[model samples]
Target: MDIDAWWGIIGQARAAVGDRADDRDSPDDPLPGALVDVLAVLEPADIIDFYVKHIEVTDAAERYPLMWASFLIEGSVSGDGFMDFRDGLALLGRETFSRAVADPDSLADLPVVVRMSRDEGGWIGFEALSLPITDAYRRVRGETDTLRAAVEAAIDGMTRPERPGGGTWDPEDDDAMRLHLPRLAALFLD
Candidate 1:
C-alpha cells in the first residue's frame, strides 16, 4: 500500500480504538483487540516497538498480544517461553492466541525470516515484508471462501463509530504503520 493509504488506515484504526475505550466499562480496559487490528498491518519488529511503547503489562497473559504480534512479524517465537516457529504460526492460524500466551518467559525462538535479516545493517530492514495471507491455508477443510469472507468481515467490522465516552477518534491510529513509509522508501532507493 502507498504511504497515504497507510496513513488513512491508521487513522481509522486509532479512531476505532479510541471509540471503543469510551464505551469501556472500566478506565483500564485492555486495548488488545483494537491494537491488534492496528498492528496487523505492520511488520513484526515494529509491532514489538509499539507494544514496548504502549503497554505496561507485567504479566504473561496480558502480554500475549505483543507476543503474538511479534510472532506474526518474525514468524518464529524463539526466546524464553515462546513457542517454536511452526507451533507459533499454527497457534495463530488456529486462533489460540488468547489461550496459549506465555508472558514472563524469555523469548528464545526468533523467526528465521527475521534473524536472517539482522546482518543487513540497514534501516531499510523488513520494508518488503507483507501480510502473508494465503488462500491454501484458508482452504483448509474446504473453508477457503468461508475464511476469506470471515477476514473481510473482520476488516469491515472495524468501521463502527466511537462511543460517547470514547476519546476523540484520531485517524492516525488506524494506519499507524504508515509512519514507517519514509524509511521503507529510503530502503527501496538503496
Candidate 2:
C-alpha cells in the first residue's frame, strides 16, 4: 500500500475507536479491534503493503526534534514506551501526524498532549497501527509465515539512514530540549 492506503486503515481505525492516543486505560481497546475488522477483508498482499508502508511512515517520523518532543511530553522513557510514543502520534491520523512530523513542538497545541502535560492523558503508542494487519495476514498465510522476510526486504531496499536525517543531539540536554521545543518543554517540564 502507498501512504494514503496505509493511512486509510489507520484513519478508519481511529474513527472507529475515537481519539485513543492517550487512553492508557485500554491500550489497544477498540482501535486494534477495529483494525482487526478492517484487515480481515484485505487480500494478504494488501496487508503486507500496509505494514511496509507503516514502517516507512514511522521511519520518516523518527527525527531528532520529534524524538526530543517525545521525551518532553513523556519524560525519562524509552524501549516499548518510546515506540508507543511514536505510535501515539501515528494514531492521531495523517493530518496530526504530518503536522507533528513537520513541527514536533506543534504537539503542545493538541488537547491530548495538553492533558498529558497535566497527567490527565491516558497513554501513548498505538503500535503504529500494525498488529491487526500482521495478525490478519499471518492467519491467512499461516503461523511462522509472518512474511517478515518480505517486509524486511522492502524496508532494506529503501535508503534508510542510520538515523532519521535530521541532525542529532543528546535528548538529555535540557538546553537543547528547551531550545528546540520551547512550547513542549514549557508544558511538560513546568
Candidate 3:
C-alpha cells in the first residue's frame, strides 16, 4: 500500500468531515468523523493495508508522543478509557482503525486530541501514555511475532530513561488537560 495515497485519502476525509461539522449545529459523535470520512473515500481492504504499513513505519511509542498522550486524554474524557477507545477503533476492523491512528494528522480531527495537543502541559503525560497505547494497539491486532515483541520491548526499555521521574500531571499544577471539558461536554450534552 502506498502510504502517501493513504495520507491523501485521510486528508480528504478530514476535510469532508470538517465540512459536515460546519453544517451541523453540533455533532453528537465527532470522534469518529475522520474514520467515517476515510471509509467514504477508500475501500476497507486498502484502508487495512494502509494502516498495517503505517504502523510498520511509525514508532507510536516514540515518534508521536503528543499524539499518543492526546489519545489517552480523549479516551478518558469520552468514558471509553484507553483500551476501550482502541477497541472501538478496532471495530473499524484491525487494519482501518490501526492505520487511522498510525497517521498522527488523522488524530487532529478528534476533538479531545486537538484540545489536549493545545493544552499547555499535556506533554507531562506523554511518557506515561505512549507505551500503553502502542501496546494496546499491538495486542488488539494480535501481533505476537518475535519482531513485534522485540520492538515493544525496545520501546518499553526506553521508558525509564525517557521519563525519569513520575511523568503524571498534577491537576492543580496544570489543568490544561481539562480546560476544554465544558466545551467538549456541551457538544455531546445537547
Candidate 4:
C-alpha cells in the first residue's frame, strides 16, 4: 500500500483508538493505532514481503536463525555458541509466540524486532529437541511462526464479506457499496 495512504489510515485509526501522537519516537516504536491500522489495510503476503525485503538475510543458514533468534529473545548477545544462543532466547514460550501470530488486536504487545529467518528452500525449521533449536530456541521459533500465522490471518480477514442473501463479493464489487457510500452522500446529497 502507498505510504501516504497508509499514514492517513494509520492516523485515523490511531485517533479512533485514542493513541497519542507525541508518545512514539519513530514509526517503528509501538504506535498501536498505526500497527493495527496498517495491518488492517495491508495483506499478510505484503507483510511477509516487507520483512523478507527489508531484512538483510544472509545465506549462512546455520548462523542466521541463531542470530535472529538471539536478538529477538535475548535483546543482544556478544559471543557465539549454540548453547549461548539457546540460553538467550529461552524466555519466549509457545503460546506467547502464538498470540503474536494469531491476534491482530494484540499487535502492540509484540517484541520490537519481529522478522523471520528462512533457509533457501523456504521450509520453516523448528524442532524442539534437536542439537540446535533446543527447548528455548524452538519456543522462540514457534513464536515466529505464530507471527507469520497472525499476519496471514489478518490478510485473510481483510477480504470483503459475503452478501446477505446468497452470493459473495467479487473483485469487481464497487467500493460505493463496499466502502464509500456514506462519504459520497455527505459530499453530494447532503
Return the TM-score for each candidate structure: 0.21, 0.86, 0.32, 0.22
lDDT of 4 by residue, 1-190 (tens): 3444423443453455453332222434333333344444444444444333211111111233233333333334343443333221221223332342232123223333222221112111221212221222223343346445644565565533132122222312334322322222222223
Local distance difference test values of all predictions, in order: 0.31, 0.74, 0.38, 0.31
- Top lDDT hit: 2
List the candidate 4 regions with Cα displacement exceeding 4 Å: 25-30, 49-190
Name the 10 consecutive residues with the lowest summed lDDT in model 1.
122-131
Better of 1 and 2 by TM-score: 2
Considering lDDT, which of the candidate structures 1 and 2 is the better prediction for this target? 2
In model 3, residue pairs whose N, Cα or C atoms come closer than 3 Å (at least 3 residues apart or on different chains), thus clashing, are 51-99
**Colliding residue pairs in candidate 2:** 22-122, 22-123, 24-122, 84-125
Using lDDT as the yardstick, the better of models 3 and 4 is 3
What are the runs in model 3 whose C-alpha is more than 4 Å off? Answer: 19-27, 30-44, 54-190
What would the per-residue lDDT of candidate 3 be over residues 24-120, giving only the tens digit for each residue?
A: 1133534244544444344434444444543443333222223333344453322224334443333223344444554423443554344454552
Error of 2 at 35 (Å): 1.3
Q: Summarize candidate 2's per-residue lDDT along 2-56 as a digit string, tens digits.
A: 7888888877877777755335447347767677677768887788887787777
lDDT of 1 by residue, 1-190 (tens): 4333433433454466664332122344333244345556655434333322221111223333444433333434433323233222221221232233332111223232223234322110111011212222222233335444544554454433222121222222323212322222122212
RMSD to native, candidate 4 = 21.3
